[model samples]
Target: MSEATHSFEESFDWVVVGSGAGSFASALVMRAAGHSVLILEKTAFAGGTTAKSGGVMWIPANPFMLAEGEDDTLEKAETYLDALQELDGGAAPGTSRIKRRAYLENGPRAVDFLVAQGVALRRGPDFWPDYYDELPGGCKTSRTVVAEPFDTRQLGEMRKRLRKGFAEFNVLLGDAARMGHMRTNPDAKKMLLRVALRTVRDKLLGRSFTTAGAALQGRMFKAALEKGVEIRFDSAVTELVRGRDETGAERVTGVRVEGARGSGTVGARLGVLVNAGGFGKDQAMRDRYMPGTRAEWSLVPEGDTGDLHREMERIGAQLAQMDQMVGFQTTIAPGTENDYVLPGAQSLTGKPHAILVDQSGQRYMNEGGSYELYCETMLRRNESVPAIPSWAIFDRQFVEKYKVADKFIDKKIPKGWLEAGYLHKADTIEGLAASIGVEPAALGASVARWNGFVHAGHDADFARGERRYDGCHFVGDPYADDPARGTIEKGPFYAVPVVPGDVSTYGGAVTDEWARVLRPDGSVIAGLYATGTSTASVMGNVYAGAGSSIGPSLTFGFIAARHGAGLGNLA
Candidate 1:
């Protein structure tokens, strides 16, 4: 073993960078193993995107499956995942295979471990159907698990340092309205009513209750705290330090962290795990990596500026999928510096009556496609337009039947959006198009065709009526067979200019199945690890379901910790 006599002022068995699921899971595992672990979180809060996310962990064949008598076999999983590999064209095949194997083989094991560690896992309320439902190895199952509601009070002093996404709590209803999928689904209506009642009841009972994304993150946050993981808030990792032994074997020695207390070095006796997120908000990196995107549309936290990627790259870590990122079809608030509007809750599942179009005023893709696809299309559209902002055109009737995001809609459409010209309102389709700088005649023809489809109950242009996803439910009774269908025939149409927005960048430093960073020569860099959005995503570009991002994050984090701790006789 490396001599403990090195007079290390501060050292941990493992130093986990980032506060997302990957970081927390690794720290929890190492701490549980009786190893001292210290987590350096750049932000004040420990959850990172996990806290700001819809805390579902997508694990196929989890314990919930067994309880519900669902059939999920390793063979079936392998078959499904193999199909994904075929789709990916074998990019980073080794990493992709290992990830699929880990997820399929150890998925149940990870869930069991979390449960043993006091994380209460429950079947989520709904199953977001597989994106490729028709593909082999894909089927509807209770594979999604969420942590029970977490009580932030349990964190004690730590709660003050935690950060939550400003837009997370607000409900999303505009997306559903745009798709016209469901305004009167009894189940959806009941769920909304239940949420309202619960809010009132919790207030009456002097208890706390949060539904949706907030509830999910809260549960995981509480569970991580209970496991005795040390989370340092407001501490940013400025640099990754490396050193070589007499044999010239590369190893991570420590990390330089900066905080209000002043900057200092924290040595890692075992390994350094980097889960510090992606460069979603870094203008320089975005301009370099994604030349096509407009930097203002990034919806990620301001702190996610590729610190981990830059630091790791300085030490010669290889990167993968640099051309990819988490993509979204989004609307931007007029005259605001950073206000990007995402598809409201209802729109995510395809309830709204909106379709995304390119610069020439032509529809580009399935409005119900994955957010990643939406982003990719936006980037592609930037090839032709000076700016790649699309229009999310809707009618007043659509607004009446469903809600938009709590942030966007009001008793009257926000005047700032209208006056500043980010949003355009018109009594007719032609007028609306003219206000938004589109060809009035062309837009009029498009609206007329869309209305004809709505009345005939079928979409001939792009088959918009074919969408069926769980997130599509909305409020009111639009009375349409295809729940996401509504006509623009109603006068007073509205249009909100949209751009490509993203949760985070999907591509970054590449790692193996063990979460060890790899050099350009295809060799592992001992003592170096990465997880979360800082690493190339295991899911590739397709979003299979909710919690897809965090599931692999937590899993690989555990793998990295275990691998690092088991590096016997490092000296």
Candidate 2:
């Protein structure tokens, strides 16, 4: 941290940190306002964690929703978020009624601004429901929006500099969910074939295409480049340079950055936007905030260290909700611990013929609905029961029909998985339980109770499939008679350990509704703005819906840029 009297080698009207989804949005706003903008990314890749994400934005009452006549309004969105806060035991420290209203009010406006800039955006599947769709004001038809698939060829020579998604193929994240069901569903099979053909065609034609977060970032990257927003990869903002304003009040005026060209200070005339992401890769910070979690479990790609977090703290920025994370569960299979794409187990646990059990062999939570809540439940359940590495018990029927760790169930089960004790197989439920060190009687009783629920077509214990989000296609089996409920009684049982993984930590520097970083005294740090996971999430402890984090990140980034440019209340 430098004193308030620092010199700079160069400067821009606005300097944005981290090229996530929000960074580009902020830069675009500044550039559109006829201000020079610079985006600094720590990694060689342009996109931050957003490039590796699903790229969905949970924007309520977006233009597409209104165009389609979907039932969504600002009041309803507020009610839904309010309900989430209530369910989480009141508003979290990072979120308030004002902040929530700001997010809802500006979410659609932000999307509209992006669309007006010619960014290709579209609504997610209408079948996609809110995680808590049954709650008052929750929309069952979904409020998620995503960018269309982009051709990296459009990036020209800079295409190689763009970060690739977890999957190289151009398949929508939602479609990828259904791709696992190709063996049973003809539509899924067709979609899989179409994606396969597209991949081959693109390869043959010497074209590069990407989807999901990469698609979103790719489009934004192209748009920014076209608008003449300069982006520098491998450039990291190491320390903030503070200076006194006209009123003799301290403010952040510039940033000292280091990259391939070495270190220097770059001045910011308007403000510096920090969208540098969370510290998911910082094991020390994880140990400090989220003690029981491992950094390796994070789905976020490399370079999410906490340099800015410490820098901001050194400058008196208040950090809140540091213990929160965007949980997305994953199963660690043999030889996959270091893989770029580990198989996600969130939807697997909710599929028919599968049940999650603690070490004592007891079902504890509804396996469906929000993956965020699902992983949170696992961690919470572990406080009493030994469930940090819970087991997903299933049968031959499941293995034959469904996927385990992104691989189809085949006769050739990986020898390493079984030998390393990551996967257990047995001819009977009792044998499976014993193999996993659970009492036979307890495991048998749990399976029997689950089977009874399947027969009755009702989950009396947790209501796993009762919610609109929990059924058929999203987390359930489309071919199953009950879709979400099925018996695990077939012989040749299997069990795999499941752990709470995450895309990123969901906490950091605290900010106001305008996205201005605030000190503990509730005073704004002039010329300092933050969005994305770099700031304590405005949604608080709750993951409101798909892309809740991304939506807020983009919306707040837009708001921050507009505010910094003296454009008040654009929403």
Candidate 3:
């Protein structure tokens, strides 16, 4: 069938492509500058990945912390960022530096702007340790902030323009609904008991009861709407329009967007911002750029086809870190699609008690390391798959102590996984490996070594019990002396096969500190900017604190908008 067409005569001083935090923040900045801005979103709704994310923006040494009597400084923040760069082994220095400066310097301003635009900010301190506490200026501090619970009903007609699916927002809303049901009906025990308990705890602490991802996105969405920014959904920019200016260089003129009924061209007098997401979900691009991953395992939305990246590439934009992608443990769910098992961070869940092994059944790096490192290590090992599907082999003691992300006591493990023969349950290590088609002898030896470390309260093979890594902790027993150690001595052993799952790919088109897309010849692509997961992420390989992804996305997006408006040179 021929592509659908949509036409309209609309012009804006600024045009933003994508609706995540970055695009929304940039659009707000431009609008604040007294420019009429139009935001084009490919999906039916706005709030790209930002709506589905945790909504914590990681801004080290932010003013919000200081206002709340927390101690943080730019120098200390820089030290922490530098420590992360050192861990990258100099592979992403530019990304690290740009993101660090953007977040450290502009973070406070970004928060202020959003708050002024009706976004409520609550001081949500970093509950986990800093990834580089051993380095100078690296200590856990209250540097994160989450938006207050926003009522989606406030959006009125605008709510219809949001991307709807299993996006972060939807996930949060779904979970919240379940939680809310439990709160109103205490007699409905079982799973509802957990929900009711969480609701009461949050309410008692004066925290927003909206714990799901949607609440996070809703806050940003509410802030953007209050700023008078108009979002056009179902609008996919097909091609970039450029022309020669007085400086004998190319400049963006407008964009040709294809929609439902017809196609139309919209012009931007100031600039065009491209925040379209990465090419993770695009099989052809995945094969060409990231050959190591299984193309079918992407968890991104269907709308994320990398059209913006390809369009920019045609115009001679430079790309960086194309080989890198955000990896996580994933599994093939029968009848549906591949489902990525989210990372178990100290903040989200708790320290992992299991170790990740390769197909040969040998331990690799620390299982509690950053997911970025996990992905890199998996690729370096050259496993049969880009990321080998492995088991989180733990004894009964682990299951009794810590709660896994989705493996609650009440909910039955999905039949798809059990029937497909991916999960293995056995009373012994040797038997468990046999059920999963691994060599019995190799699995036995691996388990024996791990068991020794668990029993001795030390992990010499891969330091499984070490809590030095900030990402290693979880939400469970924080008071446990050996936070990372739990004896695997229970009789009935369990094995859940997990493959690598990523929130989103971090590598993309390279941009400057102001989020301006640079050309192949080291010149700025006039009127062109990018943000969110579409640009090389500023975090590099280290996840410094919670909300790291959204933090840079908003900060750089603000910088890009100000730069586009010639405000970067002010003061």
Candidate 4:
């Protein structure tokens, strides 16, 4: 029953639900256009998955790419997209073709718009390549953009109002600033030692690390407030309230939200935006939409419970083509918080000296492949056996050369981790297998075969390190004798369990090119819109480039807000 419009929160021209990049960007655009916009976050603090992420927005042929003199164009991007649809089996099931077109056409515009609105984004590193760079239409330069650090001091009383980022690694990294400098400066060793000493000192003093995603969210929050956008936390929108016009046409007018204060209806005149994140933490929905996916392994915030899709579905929303499959996997320590599991440890997995094997001690894929391909292989293997808890077997040599997740560096494993069973160490490969409960002979033989492949620089069985996009999207020494292939001959082997993990669910409420939620019959639901993971990702099944997730989020959120505000539909 509708609350007779008598008791309500202060009405706004537009009510935005959720505070992810898409939702926050929508609120910013709406308010910038002079609309009365309200931002509601279910969690006590703002910044959803985006704030906990790399804060990179993938925009193909974006303004950033254009400014960099990269030869990217709308037609070329479409050609690339065509290949993606082929990967998804066809055009995404319920979504219109125009939706994909809209994303391609306006992705640059959205980035430019957000930059103009005070988002502190900079082009991602030049060394970074598309996740699937070898695929047709992939550009070789920076397309994903990262945010410059935002000063939390500016938030003042609102300083602690942001959600913690990836165990605060994305935020807290006093020494991480040195990596950027080391890349460009000649005295790299000196700079690295300087940051290392400071990092050690800060850790000893228990100083908090603050940077990256949190900074971006802080800046975005600051921008929203500067533009007069009002945000209320701990307010969960329970239902989308609709009203009828004289012609009997149904349209969403407001939302029914419950909070610490009390339950109340909040009216919106321009439109109601449901940009809450996907069903990462919603187990019931996960089983229904993404069977075999684990909630405990997801990187999304706890508040990403698919609430927006649930409410919108009750009002006749349809499901778009959400393959909603296993996203990606990374090695995680046993006792670490789920949020703290090595952000984009793609480098860790793809580096030489390691091999991923199933529980039975069998190698199933190229260890040096992209994160998307690695998890895709893991999921495909899970179809036969339990690949969810497969092991990444590596030797002491690997640890000495590279950091594994956040656990070990420079050949040293933290004593606490060993005590907590995070690291399974053994003097011999067979012994390591026994500790992890796998076949001893099988593990030993697999390591022997991997050594043969490494010596040959060609994986006879799985072809590890053979791809152009290997080594975390071509970041480190693409020309190394074996970028991701190394002999696992050294003793004192270790095993870190791998799982089928994801940043967010790919599927959610169905929407059109203009970001309007669609009915089962494919009609646009007037006055209702969806963006980000709350809707089916426009890219279909494949991970395009980096930032593929947020690129669509920003673009469609902008498209939806613009269309809802009576700006003529440009799509």
Candidate 5:
């Protein structure tokens, strides 16, 4: 709802800061157990970065999996995490095994609880593979679950209050939507019919269903309101107010927020939850910690400026795992004044007839690999090679068959993009390489090797299409012998410059299994909990499943709420 920021009394039973998934989940869980909850959002709008995201959670062995006869176990999940920690050093600089275990144990349980309390979530595509499907604990058919479509019209006037989705991903199916494909591709008749049916159903009901990010955030907003939690927007918390408890223990009592008119304090009887978003636009922080990550490339919500970090740092919350973050390579084009359009990681890079090359015109990593994995490769390559601003070389044939998440178009390029040099066009690979400032011979050799690999139906260098995950998202080519591997022989080559991009920030103040912020000495800062991007993520750098970040975010939020409400161990 469009809640007005008003003066509040000195006390509430519990104060939740930020309105993202973790914050809302904690607030609603506390309210469900009969606590007067106050949610403070810095921005006028709700949803944060999550509303623009694909609202899915990586539930290791969620109830949905069991009900659908998919076998997943907590033990298997641990094995999978162990593989990540061993293979890729998924563990952060100062990681906690306890919290990681907590995430696995309670992630599904938290989703189950929220579902029972009326969040319309269902198992996502059963064929969806984990980003690392070959790992020990990885399931071939992923256990990720997404929020079902929600009609924002149900919120009435609040529909206007939501933060606008990213122009790059603001469409109906937002994340990786292939609407334009099914509409024209004769082979996609069944999918096209399904889309048409859904559109009709939505119209018949006199409601426009919001998918992906909107669906998830809308449900959380509705659930919070249904349980009578008071949400105050435009109330930016500036400091954590510390005071002595009745027992003379110095603890976090409340927060100091700059209100619309003036600054005031909102007290919390139990504890304060800081589930606020990351510091994506915080140029200072980016310069200090993640120097390589450009502020312009970050896709976080406008309101995220690391308020929780600033306030919690004063209280001595140990902030580790800062090195780990979320990102993918993207090529952006201008949209409205501040908004921009771009392609997603899997949308174009994973498609056939594409080979990403560094400045030396060498394929650094598998082009069809997960964005996270490939970018990690690029980051390591940046130290010795010019991996920053890599290029994706493609022919007109690929563009004809598919667009990048429907952001990049087909047949012809926009005049603005071409003029701005965002989309480089050349008739030959040598011309394309020279246009983009790369060695012509190296580019030619890379494409030649790529064609050889495709002819063999196996990538000997990086194993691009060997796994199910690679083939899973492929837009099949009718003429190609191997759909995942196609020769980039068609003329009119194109190149889009890509940077080592991170989409979201991970790692914040360290927290325990109970979601309570911790000290350098591993003691709890009593009455203070943080989740989502506000605290160091439980999974460290690993994107365990599709919903890794959100799953731990919500589960930790549940753990905090239950513990604070005097109910023991919701996990």
Candidate 6:
């Protein structure tokens, strides 16, 4: 609990917290509406966990999709979103019918506003289907929007302050997705070469460049700075300053901040928006919400320690769906211990010649489709089966054909990975089973069954590559006749422990369609707003598409700023 500070050292029309996707978008809206907006970033960097992410925003019926002649509409998107709700078994308050309508109606407008503001955005890959494109109203083509590659050199001295992304290469999201097919596809090889050449040329010219999330944030940071949105980095909001309104209801008036200058109260004349991210780094919060999940498996930055989440809780903000996370399945490679960014194994497990199995050496669920579903299944399966850390079993053919940990695999295994027990290898199926502590016959049976599927070109037990997302070039081999099916009967077999990892926690304070924070009784906490992972996700518990997390974050933030600035939902 925090005492309401009566006085303040500084005041702005709108005070935004956390420099993730939502922060910049809302601040831009505030500035455009001629209000004094201040973005308070807890970390030195401009972008929060978003900068380390894929940076794709899944906005159905977006302008870019429509402009490309893709058949999509808000009604279609509504059906798609509605169809996914049944998967949760009930209506989620966070993603209520009104909230869903709000997102669909305003999402395109938000993108339009960004475009009108000169943010260079484009549609994602042509084949980048919705995670559940097979579902009703789901488009087979992409509904994603991503920022173009940005040259950070344009940021001047602030370039150093912008956070780098998870990917080291300066490749577009589409090109990066195709990079997995470099070995098998000629076009993919050319794309890789082009990116490599661009990297070398940029290096020689002393020009710094970044792609994906970094690129998006870099552009947003530039736009925000240009719009005169004052951003104070290292300024953490430790408490929310509340005041009673004429109606006897508590309203957030300001924030108690701890930063480089020291502790002080910063008041907001309009309202305070807390887009300060989720509690991915807090073990206690994880235990309380998502039990049995370790904070170490999270890829959120150090600053995502739930400072504002606690503050919002203290101020009586309703927190919903606290157990959900944007799961990005990962494998522990050598030197990856304790690192914020671990190599994701979503591609590995979905690729041909590979299958995930439990301790008893039996395949359970479909190893493809959404990574969120895959990891959630892993955690749920652990209740009855020993599958917290499942084994991804493959053969030498897979190693030679595809990438392992996003690196090209050669004939010889990495010695450090093998020595540190991060990777296990054996000559025969029985030997591999013995090494991984599973019954040899069981392991052999699973492999033989999977091989039969590969030969028959259909998975009867668990359809591996059934989904459009599963058969994508990145998840499966591009050259193979059936991209997602291949036999695992080569000389030496390999295995790695795959854990349910995440980019960020997905749940937090509950907010309305206006992006205003709400109390348990469904009353709005006037003068308080939230978006991004700071609020319970708009998609409820399921990941809608490639950029489900970032898309809703950015859209709701846009809505919040408009409401706070008295603009009212961009007309």
What are the lDDT figures for the candidates, one per model? 0.66, 0.88, 0.65, 0.74, 0.76, 0.86
Which of the predicted structures, 1 or 3, would earn the higher TM-score when compared with the native?
Answer: 1
What is the C-alpha lDDT profile of model 6 across 403-443, one tens digit per residue?
A: 78756666666659888887888999999999989999999
Better of 2 and 6 by lDDT: 2
Per-residue lDDT of candidate 5, residues 1-571 (tens digit) = 0102323356788898888888888888898888899988888888877887776778888888899887899999888887887765456743467767888888888888889889988887664677778989888887887887777777787777665554212233422344444533454666656766767877887876777766888888888888898888888998887777766777888888886737888888889999888887788987777767777777777788887887788789998767667766776654522443245545566677887899999997877666666667777888799878888788977777766434546756765777877778899999998998999999999999998998888899999877666755432332334546678999888888777666677878988889999898989898899888888777767666667777777788888998889888754
| Model 1 lDDT, full chain set | 0.66
- Flag clash pairs in model 5: 58-547, 327-502, 327-503, 508-536
Lowest-sum lDDT 10-residue window in model 2: 1-10
> Residue 142 CA error for candidate 1 (Å)?
5.1
Task: For candidate 3, write residues 295-360 as lDDT tens digits.
Answer: 566656657778988888888788776666666545444544534323332222124345555666
Give the Å shift of residue 20 in candidate 3.
0.7
Q: Please provide the root mean square deviation of candidate 3 (C-alpha atoms, Å).
A: 5.8
What is the descending lDDT order?
Answer: 2, 6, 5, 4, 1, 3
Per-residue alpha-carbon lDDT of model 2 for 38-131, expressed as tens digits? 9998999988888898888999999999999877899998998999888989877678899889999998998988988879999987767888
Segments in model 1 whose C-alpha atoms lie over 4 Å from true places: 3-7, 85-95, 165-197, 200-206, 210-217, 244-248, 334-349, 385-387, 405-411, 452-461, 474-480, 567-571
Off by over 4 Å in 6: 1-5, 204-206, 245-249, 338-340
**Angstrom error at residue 412, model 1:** 2.9
Question: How many residue pairs of model 4 clash at the backbone?
Answer: 4
Clashing pairs in 2: 4-242
| lDDT preference between candidates 1 and 4, better one | 4
TM-score comparison, 4 vs 5, better candidate: 5
Error of 3 at 437 (Å): 2.8
True-vs-predicted CA distance for residue 456, candidate 4, Å: 3.0
TM-score of 3: 0.85
